[model samples]
Target chain A: MDIDQILDSVSPIHKDPKAILKSYIKEVNFPKGHLLLHAQKCEKSIYFIKKGIVRAYSNTAENEVTFWFGKEGDAVISMKSYIANQPSYENIEVLEHSCFYEMNHTELQKLYNEHIEIANWGRKFAENELLKTEERLISRQFRTASERYNELLKNHPHLIKRVQLSHIASYLGITQVSLSRIRAAKN
Target chain B: MDIDQILDSVSPIHKDPKAILKSYIKEVNFPKGHLLLHAQKCEKSIYFIKKGIVRAYSNTAENEVTFWFGKEGDAVISMKSYIANQPSYENIEVLEHSCFYEMNHTELQKLYNEHIEIANWGRKFAENELLKTEERLISRQFRTASERYNELLKNHPHLIKRVQLSHIASYLGITQVSLSRIRAAKN
Candidate 1:
């Protein structure tokens, strides 16, 4: 999609579209296997994927967990660090060659300042992120690994096709061996 | 501090003081042990505490997990549900008799548009929440019960002093007995 379409996709709830869509956005492209944003860096901008895929994950001492995956028309950033103005705890890596429109923190604040519609969009995004996080937390708290895997398959089928099995295993909080067994059982 | 100071604290970040201290913001007081926001209902606005404490916890089938504790100068709400216009999964209960400015989602969005500083502040707050959640996830992954308890002690010394052991236990992903043991060991 072109810049205008991308901006339009920014939010349907926008009432003051003209004010929010300021002229600061710049579209950029990245090659596959590239790290668009690294962990431990403070993010000044949140990326909007016009055409591409990116994965957000973090490595602890023991292992890594895939926090999320972003596809076309999705927003990708290490949300916590980006919002907190602290160094990010998650690594955002490009999974495929992609095109993105960058909206830096200052620009977003400008949008928030210029238009209530933009602030509303931001509020909506925050709420969306919260729901997704809550769902992950609850699923981790209650669901069995197998159940989660099934739900993931039903909801984000493209993830299975796009991501490596190891990342999938990490995301599910299970061993690769367990995932393999599950896959075999299904077959 | 007075309302001016509060407004001042927000001005550098939100540029416009009038937009933030807008008409929707009315003063509200909660007695100790009052519920500010309830689970299973849509939260219209978030409360910004001028003084006192509030707890945000979710009720699972087996137990309740205390995830958030807001103090003076902190904003409290069923954040996920509040942002998303969905029913809240967690409830905010006032732990200390408190005074706060109650601002709903719509009014806050309006404020963000009118005041750039408020929008920046909102981002910072969201970032803080995200960082906390990431820390919680990592703590769950890497820390022992004793380690987690110690981390909590170091991070939120005041929380230990103000809240019940049961709530702390839930927050730390342990039992009250474990907290008692940890406390005993600390001494």
Candidate 2:
């Protein structure tokens, strides 16, 4: 879907708000395995996924920890760097060849200032992102690995097929072997 | 600070925006140990702390997990419940006698629709909350207890004095004994 259609899907914005968004947002594409952002680099833009999947992760000395995955209709941004205006410790990498409507952070802020609907959109977008992060944090604190795996199966079964088991395990804060065991038990 | 001064501190909004916000927001006080919001209930309002501290936590069969703390100038809300419009699984409790500017979620939404600056403020507020949640998630995923403790000391040392050590330990995802050891070693 184009920007107008996507905006309509959420809430119908008038021509002025749509025009402001379209002016600042540009369509972009990336190949599979592309790093949209790298650790220690600042993220200057937000991407609204039109197609494919992207993963956000950080690394330790031993391995990388996958924390977030964005798919079609979702907006992806480095919350720390985007809000705090600092270098990100996480890398945002494409899991599949992806298409996105990309908006520079500065331009988006300008749009927010220029239009009320756009600002409301920005607020809703941030709230949605916050809700996702809070859910993940709560799951990590309270749920076991198997329970988390079950939640993934129940809520986002497509992720199991699209993402690698290793990445899924990392996202669940469990080892690949443990994830395998969970899968085996479920099957 | 009153609503006007608080709004001025962020960015000088005109009287229209300030009046709109003030109309929706009401000052309220809670005695120490009050549950501003209890588990399994919907959070109808967001609180901006004028004074004192608040703790947000969830409980398992075994124990309560303290996840967040809000102090002066902070806005506290249950992101998942507030954004998703569902009953909260966590509890928001007053840690001390507190004063806050509280705004009903529905009224705040109305204000966002009626005013551009208010929408901008809401957007910024959500972004700030998302940043904090992301930081905590990253810290939990990547940092050790001792490292997290050091970060807390460096960033929010006053919390150590104001909050109970047990709650602080829970926030760090460590046991009270481990926190005592860390403190003893530091001393």
Against the true structure, whose TM-score is highest?
Answer: 2
Put down candidate 1 lDDT per residue, B1-187, tens digits, no spaces.
4454555454344335554455567888989989888889988877778888789888878878887667777767776565657788778888888999877787766666665456655645554555556566666645677897888778779878989989988776678998899889877
TM-score per model over all chains: 0.78, 0.88
Candidate 2, residue A20: CA error in Å?
Answer: 3.8
| Candidate 1 residue pairs in clash (backbone atoms < 3 Å) | A83-B127, A84-B127, B13-B117, B14-B116, B14-B117, B14-B118, B15-B117, B45-B104
TM-score of chain B of each: 0.81, 0.91
Q: Model 2: what TM-score?
A: 0.88
Question: Model 2, range B1-187, lDDT digits (tens) per residue?
Answer: 5666665654567787788788877899999999988788888988788888899898888999998887788777766567778888778889889999888988888888988998888788788778878778888777778998899889888877888999989888879999999999987
The alpha-carbon interface RMSD of model 1 comes to 3.2
Q: How is the predicted docking of candidate 2 categorized under the CAPRI scheme?
A: medium
Grade the docking of candidate 1: acceptable
Writing each residue's lDDT as its tens digit, candidate 2 over A77-157 gives 777677778888778899888899998987877778988998898788777778878878888777888998899888788
DockQ, all models: 0.27, 0.73
